[model samples]
Target: MLPLCSCAVIQSHPTVSMLVTHGPVRCGEVRRAVTTTSSPGDKSRQRLRSVRAGAALTMLTPLCTLVYVATTWSAGNRPAMAMICVSMLVLAAVALAGAQAIERAGRRATVQMAGLVVNIAGFTALALLDGGLKSAVGAYLPFLVIMLAVGMPLRPFLAVAGLAVAGYWTVAIIGGPAQMSYAVIHTIHTGIIATLCLRYSAAMVSLQRRLSDLSRIDPLTGCLNRRGFEERLANELAEAERTGDSAVLLLVDLDGFKEINDRYGHQAGDDLLVWTGRTIDEQLRTHDAVGRVGGDEFAAVLSGIEPDGVPVVLERLHAALDGVASAGIGYACYPAEATSPEALKEIADRRVYRDKVDHNRQVPAEAAVAGARGDGARRQSAKVSRHERRRRAITETGRLGISTPGMGLLYVLLFAGGHPNRWLMATLLTVAVTLGVTTVAAAARLSRSSAAAMIMPIVGALQFTICTVVVCLDGGASSTPALGMLTTLPLIALISPRAVLLPFAASAFVAIAVFVGVSSTWYAIGHLTSALVVSLVCASRGRVAAEQRRKLRELSRVDALTQCLNRRGFMERSTAELAHAHRHRRDLSLLILDLDRFKEVNDSEGHAAGDELLCWVGATLRERLHPHDVVGRLGGDEFVVLLSSHSAGETDDVAGDLEAALAERIGVSVGAGVLGRHGTDLEGLYAHADAELYRRKLARGRGRSRRPAAPADGNALVA
Candidate 1:
């Protein structure tokens, strides 16, 4: 029974713990805690300048050893000389490796301290191993002073000094004992030097901390600046990657900051910024960090938090910022929301702007009321004054008995040739009839009406009959005269242009026909020549006017920045296309594209880069699009495209292609929306497309991945 009880106890109590007294905690938990601590440390860690100094010292130590070797060789004792040479080589190698380590590992101040120790210890060992100290101690003193000057903390400085002193004593004791007087003097000198060096080192550390603070902190808000925030965030991410711990970063931006600056002045705006920064800082945990990454923009790094906790953190931030006199807040979290710094910032900025827009919408209502009141008052005042001025002008005109010029000229022409020749009368009547017919025919042709097309031949026949009548009236001379009249009619009609040209052409043709029929051979020839000259003059004038009108139309349709079709052109063309598609039951698609974060570019790099970016985007679209696809530049970095034959899937594919292309070139996200056959006409299509575009833009603002519109076909209509 005793043996069985002992066996049971031995089996039940495992001896693993007995072997090691204390067991280790889980490696995962230890890593998690380290990661959490290290995240905050990265954000608030002070940069030590002493590391650079250590590197410099390490490099100089090797050269100093060489100098010591030369001096010792001059003082020559053969056996000790070989030891000195060997010691110098060994110390130099150690110094080189220490220098390399310090230079490579910047934030490892502990490692740098260890390197200094090695360097100092190696010099001490060399001193004891060789008899070169009498000459080498002085040479080494400069290096020790340099190490102290660079920013080694007091402990490291003192340690180095102790090593130097010990090494000197070891050399003295080994070479043969020194006198008491010399030892006492040496000790006093060493103490003074060490004290001064330590004091200097302390001064450097303070200076370095101050400079680091200056570089990293925002002067206006006491938050880390953008550079500091980025540096800290990157380190945090790296640590999270290594430790498998989740961390979140939030980009916070204050909305309507510019409006505050504009309305209340920049001083109030600056104060508001300071208030926001302080408020955000207070709301964050001690383990978190906040930074002012831009004007009116701040960022926070939350360590050791679940990704899902981001929304709660954002809510807390929002609650803290809400109802703060005149501020709006937007925040985006990392890992849970976005994997990249830029993506997070973009999401935050978009939300901020959305809030800003909402705020602005409310503000404008009050302004609108004020504006309406002012407008009403101004309108009443202007109405009375305008009526009075009109009355005065009418009275003055009545007193002067003034009449517009040109009525007399019109009457003179109307009655000029009373009892006009029968041939001429016939010519005039024929011209009128011919012009009416041609005018109707041209209108029908432009309308593209089948009924009009059927009437065109009849109208053309009527014109010919009128000319024939005029020719018969004038006999053989009428042809020349008829041609003259035909030419003159079109020219005179040009005064009213579109409306009058056909009638004028008819009249000129009839006149020339009558002249050619009635006149003698010589008269007919003269009439033809005169008519030819008149027709040439009229043709030239009409062409010039048409050219001018075309130029005006072109100007109206084009955007100045991108040279793409303007909004008016888009609306007009879209309306026409919709009407046609509705009538024909043909398929049509509309796509709208908007550039992301365009305003930021405008803000940071000035409007010039923004303009350049827009132009580049337009050029890229043009190059990528098929000839038939119509691309138009809408206002403010917005563009629209029309695809005549594409299905929704094809359109989506094109959008994605375009988005990828644009992303490569400008680093701007392009959002696209498509309108399918469901769009009854151009307007409906455009509205649907625009809605989709807006939805895509909103999704992008929410930090979602989006594809661009399909590449346009070469044959697609471009505005």
Candidate 2:
């Protein structure tokens, strides 16, 4: 079945409904949100073309073989040869037709099933080609090999194998006694080899599948990792360009996730991330892609969104994140705002940070304090930070732990066939595969992602150790030390190269001592020395690249002027605080403030003095509020604050304090709103406070209009 989804929207002037679009993804599967990614202009159609080309290639081989056989060997029974040639051509055409149908439907199962039927038919026709089965068997065996060459999946391959065995039995029945025994033995040999080929093919497919998943997925949340998200965005960009369509890219970052990880424990933090991913996925359509691009950030691709539809789609996404987490979303449209994927990403990323700043600036007083404290007073798990968890992962596993099964299979192959440890290697491969799959479920259940990073490294290390011992037990006959060196080398580069070396080297020394004895200590020393040299080179290159990226990310969100959290940073902090406050039934408030007559001052004084004045205002506000309080400027002279644990009265007091401080200067108007009373939403809170500010400004305007009949010169009015 072609899995697809449709969305319908009915809009009115007043309120927009939540059910504007129906998506295939239900709520709560954030990390596992599914997207088609393939539109009319995507690579899926290109692949169909490739498959058609393959079909043609497969067709030519059989056609040439049939014609050659008919011309060269159809001596006495020309009628039988003619019949066989016709059957092969007809079978080839039918097979191509079946493949074409599958290409249209894009179904792999059809490929397997159709290929099986065609292969069986062709083999049966070949078996009956000559004067008798005896003469035909020799000619028919080559076609059986050709049948194996068709790129059918495992099930159809097995079916084809069974049919070949059946054909051989029919041949044996039609043959003389001597021919019958020879056919029986040949069939048995063919069956064994086919079984092994099938097994190897299955393993290769499995390995490819797991590796592909690793590149695209976030190991912890099971969402699209950064690389995967970027690739999909590129595809979306291509689709939009080719088809003249429009799509939106939303870069979502969790507000206060660092605090959550710091306070509630990394485990709680991970659960929150999982919940966030699932929530975003739930809000998206089947054609939308949600990816965890940063530590606490996710990006989404919304296809089929009209310019007007952007607001509704964004609203749905916000609603999903309401209580669990506060999210700052930055989005850009293709063909509208950006011409390329990188441009789209840059625009969205900048906007997301700006939104985060707005959120942070409006954060309630107490929430800011709690955030600064960096501890979940309500539910702190074992003390673990995101960085520490990462440190442990690399130091322990030396892996991001994305593709353990694939890596382990390589280790198995390196251990080779003759080693007694080959079976041991096989067991390790199975365990590694099982471990990688189960770790996700386990982490979800445990609410700890550290386990995800830790398990695979241990399994890999253990596998290496076992392989080494098995090789040593056989008197170090194999290149055991060499395999050990290659496998153990990742441990050096993935972690702090210098830091991890001592323990790794010590462990290697003991193992080598136990196995090779004192005479080969030079081999062990050489291994460690050379490995260290390589590790240092890798570490130098890796750290520089990692550092450059880290700095770029920091530069992206930092405010150029006031040096406070910019608009996006404020929003990033505030959203999570608001959500946490709501979830816990804690008091929360918003304060929107703006300088009176700031534009007049800018006109009178130079723009430089105006900038200095704005800087002073930012500094003064930061000083008056607690360290936990987040302050942000919404361009121009407007400012906002998010106050956690602040009641209506406390909200008023804070607002009044800031206003009194500013009264000596150009003056500041403050508007306050409390959660549950003023509004629960970030946008609503700002609107409510801004409304109050406008009300006060209007009152001042009326008062000033009545009292101020100033002289034209203005000097007499002051006196």
Candidate 3:
């Protein structure tokens, strides 16, 4: 009933869980089992403990045999009973001592065999003394088999088997027909043990092989992983040090992997990586080892190579990699390039990085060349687009009625005429005229009404300067004096009511100085005085006009909210860019961005949030864009960008980058349109880009937007 109860309880729960629930009692049992199994000590201490345990067990075993012998002797067949008793005791003691020695000696092959020899000797003696087969010699066979199998190698197992067979034959012969049954039983037992030992040995070998394979191979690249490489490298370095041979280490990197992933799909990039790995493997020598150390990075170790040969090996690798698209190779050698395996790897890795940098530097030039060969029409269209952009800028500026300060300097020169400092006068005149003409032209295009007013004063100033210069150059009673007085008189009067007296005073001082230097009469002095007065008055007036013009231009060109260049400023510069592109037959691209659903912000979050969004977008764009790219807000939620020196494809790339950059923030759709090689002029490009932008917005709404489309002719439109 107790056994039945125990079985039921045990069946209800796992043995381990039950044991844990039993707490200290079960824990004590487990602890006792562990202590019996192995102990921490010097070999002798552990051996002593094992010896004691074995001796006690052996003693008990023989005593039990004596009881069996006594029962047999009690049946009245006691002739050798006493001798058997003495023999059993002696054999038990001997077995105990032998086990102790085996444990103490740590079971070296020689020592274990010696112990086996002692056990065999004891058993053989017992069999011979007990009349061989007449005794239960087969009973001792199991003990011998266990000892030999547990403590010794295959040699001992074979020896035990041989000895067991020999002992069986000896018993059969010595005891004649009386011990035949015992011999048969002993033979059967020995055979079973040998078969089990052989099976266990095979299992161990199979498991060891499986572990070795798992530890060494990398599943991804089917090469060594970092762990395997480190192990292999250590072994190689040790071998090289011992053999006085050198090996080369190489580090290879894939260049433009990130760009490829961004432009193409990651799946394509992965295909590229696999292709690169195979190419590297094919290029390496059979003796060389390669491993993928990191993403887009690989390393190789080459043996049987001298330090000097390292460079040659690297060159070969480089050439091999060059054939593989977007691959770069770098290498270092042992015993020359570096003294240690780690150092060599470090040097190789650094070289690989430098190679990648050099490879990256060549990309732009390569793209430009490709663009030139592939898309001549797009290139022409890009130029026309740039020209239109410039014209738009000029028109915007004209509407603002603004002039830059640089223009005012021109007026100063025109009014100065042929004073002794005539070159200064000419320089100022040129600056003013250039500024005024450019500003007026831009204004006229943007706003005819404002442009007309701005143009009049500029034209009048130009005509006045021309007349003044001609009169002075002709040595006639110079209209310069009168023109100078006309320009300066107003400024002085405005600043001070008595400012009219300043010209008279300035003339008097100049005349007095001239008289001192040249002994001039009153008539000559008066002529000189008038010229001096006129020059001073004109200089003051020119300065005042220049200041006013500069302020106006700044207000026109700069965006009031963001303080960035306004649409007008961008157009002006874009026009000049177009002209340059047309002249050089280069490509230019335009990007138009209309923030999708921007009105939603104003409607839901209020106008303040909408304003914040605009400011944030503007700041973000400024930060993310390249310094050379032109950025402008084209009123409301619309913005425009002009990219120079880029092919239609390249422009698409830039636009994609901008879209991705913006996507990270506000939930807005960005659209890009490109025109080049006469496909569309600047205005047409903008319209096309805007249409594409709307298409993108529609696509986004339908969840159809994936990667923005590259332009049909390698020009791109993105939303």
Most accurate candidate by TM-score: 2
Q: Which candidate leads in lDDT?
A: 2
lDDT of 2 by residue, 421-539 (tens): 66765665465445545544444333344474455446546545544454454354223333233323433353443334446545765565566653344334433443343344334
C-alpha RMSD values across all candidates: 40.7, 19.6, 48.8
Candidate 1 structure quality by residue, lDDT tens digits, 1-719: 00000000111111111111010111111100111223444423322223333343344444544444554465444345455435544543454445445445653545545554555555555545444333333223323432242233455556666765675566556656532222333444334433433443243233323333333444445565554566567666666677777777666555544344334323344455556666676677755667765555677777788866667877777777664423344555556677676676666656655655565322112243233223221100001111222222122212111110111112223433353455464445545444553453344233444464344335444544554454444344332223223222222322222332354444544454455444233233333333333333333433444454344345445554576665555666666666666677655577767666665675565434666788888888878887666778754556787765565568777887888888874544343334444445454555455446545655656222222332222111222
In candidate 1, position 474 carries an lDDT of: 38
Task: Quote the positional error of residue 342 for candidate 1 in Å.
Answer: 1.4
Which candidate order results from sorting by TM-score in descending order? 2, 1, 3
- Which digits, one per residue and each the tens of the lDDT, describe model 3 over residues 1-719? 00000000111111111111100011001110101111134435644554545444434434543554565564333445445546645754664567666565665334334434444554555456545533433235433443233223565467666875676577567767645543553354335433443433333233322223222333223454444455556556766776888877777766554344334423344445445555566676654566655445667777778767767666766676563345556678777778787678667756665666576422222343233223211100001121332233343222211222222233335433545645654554455445546655554353334454455445434544443343343233322222222222222222222344355534533433343332223223333433333334333433443344344344445554554555456667777777677788777787777666664454355334666777787787778777777777644466778877567778767777777777765655555555564345566566556556656766677222223653333112111
**Full candidate order by lDDT, most accurate first:** 2, 3, 1
Higher lDDT: candidate 2 or 3?
2
Model 1 C-alpha lDDT versus the unseen true structure: 0.46
